[model samples]
Target chain A: MTILFLILAVLAIVGASAAMAFRSAVHAILALALAFVSLAILYLSLDAQFVGFTQIIVYVGAVAILAVFAIMMTRSDSAHHHTEVFSKSWLTGLVLAGGVFTVLAWAVLGDKTQHAAADAPAPVTTVTQIGEALMQRYAFPLEIMGLLLTAALIGAVVLAMPLLSNKSGAKSVTKGDAR
Target chain B: MTPLNGYLLLAAFLFSIGLAGALTRRNAILVLAGIELMLNAANLNFIAFWRYGTHPEALTGTMFAIFSISIAAAEAAVGLGLILAVYRHFKTTDLDEIDSLKG
Candidate 1:
């Protein structure tokens, strides 16, 4: 189990880095998908069966596809689209991220409390239990989540709608009018 | 048999990488991807704590992770939609070039 954990962790990290490093937008998105898959596996290893499958279905399935479609719609498909992959302040960002990591790692690993708290036996958190919890204890939040998703869907459609202006007291050309 | 600290460390590393990408990347979509990574790292931490915590029967961590995942999905949809809208207006997705609001 430890060996499996190590492999999955390494794979997840590699995929994440590759996602950031890849110059082509499509390649980066695909790498992100790989990372999401590995994370789902890690959740499975940790006995989170429902979260793992949801990760696969929602993230790898829906989110990745949404990103790809957004990329395609934006017409940013060419590999040579950007001459530079990163911004001018790339070093600053790296340093900031490194500093954050150092602090977090120190706090996590330097304390004995974490290790002391690590010995609990893995709980068998089956999907049925999660379902019951969601339907019973979490029903209100579940309904709120549905409302949020609906709002997001409507907002996305409104935002992505083609820009059409009719304020000049004249019917503008409905299609192929260059902005 | 991985320790809790191991998971915590991995989550930290992943979150850092995501931050770096979000800060440095020029493409808006990649920036969104970075945010997704960070969100996933947080989810991993939640699951890890749930698995290793004293009262796993409470199912708080697992439930929170599930909700976080749902929120992340909604965020991605809206974010990419906004990116598409921005691209239409600017004809480019480069973060550096979309500096019209820069004073």
Candidate 2:
């Protein structure tokens, strides 16, 4: 199990890095999907089946699709036609990323091993436990999240309205010109 | 068999890559992808700590991960909406060129 997890973890990191490095939006999103899948596998190895499923459903299923749709909807033929231009800030990005990685790596490893020699207590997490915890301990935050989603939905509708009206105006103008 | 350190290292690497993408990408959508990567990296850390850390009963990390995912979704929705609006106005998605808002 540990070996499987190690491999998956490596795959996830490599896939995510590749996704970040790619210039093509479509390819980058595809790599992200791969990374999400690998993370879901990692979650399973950790014995969090519910979380793993949620990760796949939310990240891979919904978010990935939404990203692809957004790219397709907004991207022009010219945008997709041009060769990708490498950014001048690539070196700076690499340096900052390297610094963060080194710091986090040190901190994570610096901590003493807390688990004893005894076999890890079997993971006791369940859907019911998580549900109860959310309702009892996290109900307020959950309600807040609902409000946030509602606000986002309304905002999206409002933002799209102008485009819709413009299209309608263009249609009417064409009709008047034909007459 | 993988040790706890292995997962930790992986998470760190993923986070850094995401950070790099966020910094280097000029496209707003790509930048959002980078941010998503960073969030997932944090989620990995949360699960790793839950599996290996001393506090067994504290399911705080998992709960936080769930909340973060929800927020990420909401962020993506609003961001894409804004991107679409910008594209409609300018007929392009290049961040560098969308400078009319700067003044």
Candidate 3:
């Protein structure tokens, strides 16, 4: 179990690093997908079977594909000519991230309760129980989620759709032609 | 067996990587991918806590993870749509190039 967790952790970290390191946009997105898959596997190893499966279906399946489509749609011929992949302030980002990690790791490692809490056995969590809880205890939030998703879907379409109003329509057409 | 702190450390590491990627990447889509990675890391933390925390029968962490995942999906959709719109207006996906808002 420890070995599997280590492998998945390494895979997730490697994939995330590759996503950042790759220059090509498509390759970077693909690497992100790999990271997402490894994270889902980690969820499974944590005995979160439902969440793991949902991660595969939602993240690996939907979000990655959506990103790929967005990339394809936004493609410009000049995109390939870019010299640098990372931003100019990359060192700042790296230093900040490293600092955050160090602080978090120190807090986690120093926590005395975590070591004492290891005596509890892993509890069983089945999908049926989760489903029941969702339908009973979490029904309100579930409905709200459905509403939020619908709103997001509509909002995305509106945001991406071309401006078709009489005043902006011609301008939008000219912009399309320029691209 | 790996202890809870091990998972917490891993989550922290992943979160940091995602933060670095989001801040340092040039492409807007890649930036969004970094955000997704950060969200996943948080989800991992939630599951880790659920697995190891007391009162597992309440399944609070699991429920939080599920809701968070759904919210993240919505966030991704809206963010990508915004990216698409910005791409249309600017004709480029480079982060530095889209600096009209900079005062």
Which residue pairs in model 1 clash with each other?
none
lDDT of 1 by residue, A1-179 (tens): 38898999999999999999998989999999999999999998888889999999999999999999988988765486636889999999999999999999989967665333444567877778989999999999999999999999999888887643444523453343444
- Predicted complex 2: DockQ: 0.59
Please tell me which predicted candidate would have the highest lDDT against the true structure: 1
Every candidate's CA RMSD: 2.4, 3.7, 2.4
Better structure of 1 and 2 per TM-score: 1
For residue A44, what is the lDDT in candidate 3? 86
Candidate with more favorable, higher lDDT: 2 or 3: 3
Residue range A48-166, candidate 2, lDDT tens digits: 77778889999999888988998888773234566443356678888998999989988877867565222578468878889998999999999999999999889877885563556
Q: What CAPRI-style quality would you assign to candidate 1? A: medium
| Candidate 2 C-alpha error for residue A116, in Å | 5.3
Tens digit of per-residue lDDT, candidate 3, span B1-95: 24787889889998999999999988888888889889998999999888888778899999999999999999999999999889877888889
TM-score of 2: 0.87
Alpha-carbon lDDT, every model:
0.89, 0.79, 0.87
Candidate 2 residues B1-103, lDDT tens each?
Answer: 2366777788888889899998877677778888999988889888877777676566776788788888888888888788887887677766666779742
- CAPRI tier for the interface of model 2: medium
